[model samples]
Target: MTDTATPLISLTWTDHITGRRGHLVVDRLVRGVASGGLRMREGCTLDEVAGLARGMTMKEALHYTPGARYIPLGGAKGGIDCDPRAPEAYGVLVRYLQAMRPYIAHFWTTGEDLGLTQGLVDKAAAEAGLTSSIQAVYPLLDDEEAARRRLADAFAVEVDGIGLGELAGGCGVAEAVLAALDRARRPYQDTRVALQGLGTMGGATARFLTRAGLRVVAVADAKGTVANADGLDVEALLAARDAFGTVDRAALRADDVELPGDAWLSTDAEVLVPAAISYCIDSVNQERITARWVVEAANMPVRPEAEALLTARGITVLPDVVVNSGTNAWWWWTLFGDIGADADEALGHIRRSMRTLIDLMLARAEADGTTPRAAAHALVADRLPEIAARYGWYR
Candidate 1:
């Protein structure tokens, strides 16, 4: 099915400075605008960006709230093929954004994704001659200036040293796990989690889950797996990290044992989070997972065949479309006045919305004897038509 769905528009560009390629796929548009994020990484491909664009479509539709100010927009995604660590990466990024300026001006509102940071996106967008990365959605706002200010203020707020914008997605992920465990009657203290990638999403997830009384037995970074039979000090590890999300070995406690990069999959834990790169878990590596649940904090972390295998093994897999929709939803919620710039209020809203969405997805999964991803697609199937009927497919 994925091989054949035609998008509304697809674009590709070759960076003039570095010759790296970039892509944009507007999977669908609502009210003349679509929303998604831009990711930069080596080996990025048009097909990968296309798949992510479709995922954004499902993500937007899944958050449809009737009578709410924050109506979900259509889905889109952009990606650049270049190592974000390279010296010429920023120049390539500027040229890519400049090439995508028209879309950013009128159709696609975006910010950071994998291998890129929010601040980096903002700076590059500015250099690309755009006032804001999300300017495309400005016309939809009742008060554009007020909305922009609100969003900026939200980005400024911090909770326990983490920016609110960075915390939003992870907060949603942790709440999804908590809600799933609640349905299974599992105690938080007994649930041990081993996550891959201690980046923005992974780090914030560790912080939230740790506060919720769950034991984080292991965490994986670019370096390797940092494991302890007992929980590690999440805050100290979070503080000593560089911009690339690589946890410093100097910060490791005496009890912390470093393992191979792939060792996180086999760690003794009830829940496993793959918050890093895509296609990491395939049919082979999935056999190493003993976790009861695999919550995808990263987009498309688990391959289709691996997900099937995980299901066959009686391990629940929470899909990314529903699990990681929080950051995008939070953006619209604040911009549309459903919530304000306050960190506590933003976190509360995320927790409530994510829990509700997770509950609905799991309940439908139970009723249909299907996976959460399937159930989420079913929900999107139902919601998209309702949304389209209210505000036609294209404005």
Candidate 2:
């Protein structure tokens, strides 16, 4: 196994105008290149950035397919401690990108993560005169229509009638949930799901799960939690939500019962999805969770102690590395120009890829008699030495 103690590089920057601090951490580099996402949150810190970068490394390694001979990219992450809603956000992003331009152009590439978007990444990249690191991974398509679709997918913008990339991440999680249910011979149509954090990822996941025939009984966001035993109207909630996925406090209906933010944990739903902030489910709250299965759409949403507790209680906790890999798969497809011209085809490919990955992870977990998190980490650890040796970095 490889050591996880140190990252390859870590850098910090300050925006003179906004007085904002930013950090870029590359946990590992393969062939001298790494990629991850840029996160902007008021509470984000360098340590969190480093942790996320390490997660990205493991994620990329799991995404590699031997059949395709795909060499996985290394893990790296960028974070800025600032409010994304502030008026100075754009300026801060510009300054941050300018400071990170060299790494962007030469060694590291990043995209949208929590509190950030692909549009912002594009804007800052353009300002820095740097091509997106995504462009480097895949071959350039000669067809103009395909190129347009590719850009639309990457930037989460509508182009030529194609919708945004909001569904990518959730769709992956939905597929993983379905796979897990199928493996257990559980009927998804009758399964009740409680979703915490109805933000972009959670909202999309709710929509996909509902469409796939699951009943989402409860939903929550930053504002509050709402539930209907019969099943919440996901479409109505989506319509009522703001662009940031916050439902107005005054928008609750007569039948909707509002609860404290953490009350979602007490719901008797068979499936629970945590898609909001990190460390949301910890030792203190783990005892309250009633879901038999927890799919992590948000990175590190479950603390180690919480996960261990849940596992001890016979709850199946699917790690974010596998459950929330749809966007990463989308990025892989986009980079290699593997996705077809049609949107449906692209989505189908993503879902299929998710299913395959989930199956592999589950099988590995069963064989090793370990949790999916350990299985995934072990898989990456097994491959790291070979990768490092190839790059002449192994001791």
Candidate 3:
């Protein structure tokens, strides 16, 4: 939430084969473990990973319950600077994981992030001589075998042909949207949404929001934007995506008008969800947005200045640390026996948790007379010190 303090560990790795750079930052640790994901994309940097690591810390703390077995771990993140679609991207990822094996075995528990999938990350981790990308957290499990199976079962269960793993975060995002809309006394049936990115997070969000009666009028992928004023066929578009989250043009409906990728930013809609890469929205493009609320589903998708501008315009910017946190939380909830592998149970838990969290955040923002981001920072600022006091900051 706030600026990242001095990290417990920071390392930059160079892939021996491709010389692609990778970075890992352990922003903080709780109870000997840190949790985050590994992402692969062009131009990923140490600073970005550091910021993401800090966000993870806040996210973990935000979910802290008065008494829960899944005590939140500290925050950490791993990044590899390479296109996941490139031929050698797999090799680069495996080597990067190999280089960080010690950390992965000790302090860092990671899965897939942007530009990577859980299946692919698992495969890469196997090749990297690791038990699992999240093996670092095994020491905390009460029954490692049952916990592993719970998470695995959750991943294997698919709703409407999309893995539950992919839907959890989007479900949280949708809940956040619904929460804001309900608070404003707005009807979901009349609301329209424009989303940037058709990747795991964005695509799943479209599915849930559509199911909830919101018209997903526009969606953007690497190719371009597809728009239909009368809601999109989220499932059809989802089926058209490749492993990299690019939708196939052949699947587009005739009436679905194609626009530039940036068009999603300016599309006429009540809500805009940026579920893609970081810093995609700057002060310049922030002007094009008329959406009443900007729900961040991606890590650091909106720049500080852009958020400031959006807030000045009376647009509620729901911070990512609160919005797209379900996927990470889902993992721990299952692993720590807080929830089972059942889809309904998982989603119900996420909805209740996100709605409660959003309500608390919005209330604090109101009480403090500040933007949601600053309020979230303030909340984290209070929780982090208490968590550290009890957990010893790091193992």
How many times do residue backbones clash in model 3?
A: 0
Summarize candidate 2's per-residue lDDT along 143-255 as a digit string, tens digits.
Answer: 54565466565645433322447777888889989999999999988899998877768988998899899999898887678998888888778777875678876666778
TM-score of each: 0.98, 0.90, 0.98
lDDT of 3 by residue, 293-383 (tens): 9999999999999999999999999999999999999999999999998999999999999999899899899999988888888888888
Residue 200, model 3: lDDT of 90
lDDT of 1: 0.93
Candidate 2: residue 341 lDDT (0-100): 41
Query: 2 or 3, which is superior by TM-score?
Result: 3
Report lDDT (Cα) of residue 346, candidate 3. 95
Model 1, position 166, has a per-residue lDDT of 89
Residues forming the 10-long window of minimal summed lDDT in candidate 2: 155-164
RMSD of each: 1.3, 3.1, 1.1
Q: Which of the predicted structures, 1 or 2, would earn the higher lDDT when compared with the native?
A: 1
Stretches of model 3 off by over 4 angstroms after superposition: 1-4
